[model samples]
Target: MGIIDFFVNLLKDPRGFIAGWIVALGPIWVYTPLFLIVFVETGLVFFPFLPGDSLLFAAGVFSADGGGLNLWATLIVFYLAAVLGNTSNYWIARLFGSRIIDSGKVKALTPERMAKLDHFFERYGGLTIVITRFMPFFRTFAPFIAGTGHMNFAKFTFFNVIGGVTWVSLFVLVGYFFGGVPFVQEHFEVIVLGIVAVSVAPAFIGVIKAAMNGRKGKGGE
Candidate 1:
């Protein structure tokens, strides 16, 4: 199959794909692509649509079921991928943020959203990095905003590590414990979608809250 078809299949059933990969490619060979998926999802701003939470959960399930991927190694690889992804994203923002914003070539970086994120970073300071890690689209954007805003590297690194480790551990552990349940196994793709929905819900709520608050402030004025 072509590249697009290949990724579509993988995204459609990441759990099965990972399991098959483990069986076919073995533990050692599977790490690179897995790591790159997690890394590119966050590290490259243009590719946030890549599956992050489901992939981790699926990896956990594969590892738990005596698949080729070991439990501890899965966690470590994913955690590092996440951490390094954010770090790379931040540096990319620092280096090319203004040019990207000014050029307006990328459709995702809308002015209003960037302003909101800028305000978010300013309002929450360093913790935004940690908080957004569990939230889908925002998680990718938070570090970029931090970099664009010139947030201190030390502070960014501190929270980046915490967020990366926590996020990876949570989903992976969830998958290990619950992913192989009979119901879940039968309906794995639906569950993966559910996971993504739940992960993105917080950021969605936050956006709604902010919008409501903005309206209230306007009414008051």
Candidate 2:
């Protein structure tokens, strides 16, 4: 498939795409892209749109009985990918986040999103790291924002490990257990979309709430 088609397939049908990879790449080599996707999605703030949640769920499905992948291996690879990815993003931000944010180059880091992240940090404190792990766009940006001096390395790592393990385990095991149901097998694409929607709902809600608050402030003035 062409590059566009490749991503299109990945986005549209993560389960089918992953199953194809297991067949084509075999059990061992398939972990490379799995690792890379999770890594890049978490590590690179610009790639927040990547399918982190759905991909994990899909991998979990494939790791089921008679499925090609080993459950333990999948879990380990994802755990490492998630933790290391956040660590990489944290350092990148600690070193260059201000410059990157000021450069006006990353269109994804919008004013509203930044404000939302700030709200999370202020409201949740260091626990924001663990909380946002299940949130798609926020998860990608949380470490970067934390690394901008809102949090120190030691504290960040504590929540990072907790968040990574919890997030990966939850989605993967859910998929492993439920992916074979008749409804899920019949409507896998729909399920993937549902996962993406549920994962992104909080970020959308935060944006709406922020917009509303901005309006209220203007009215009070």
Best by TM-score: 2
Model 2 per-residue lDDT tens digits across residues 67-166? 8989999999999999999999999999999999999888989988888889889999989999999898889999999999899999999999999999
lDDT of 2 at 103: 95
What's the lDDT for candidate 1?
0.84
Looking at model 1, the pairs that clash are: none
| Each prediction's whole-model lDDT (CA) | 0.84, 0.92
Best by lDDT: 2
> What residue pairs clash in candidate 2, if any at all?
none
Clashing pairs counted in every model: 0, 0
Model 1: lowest-lDDT 10 consecutive positions? 106-115
Q: Model 2 segments beyond 4 Å from truth?
A: 1-5
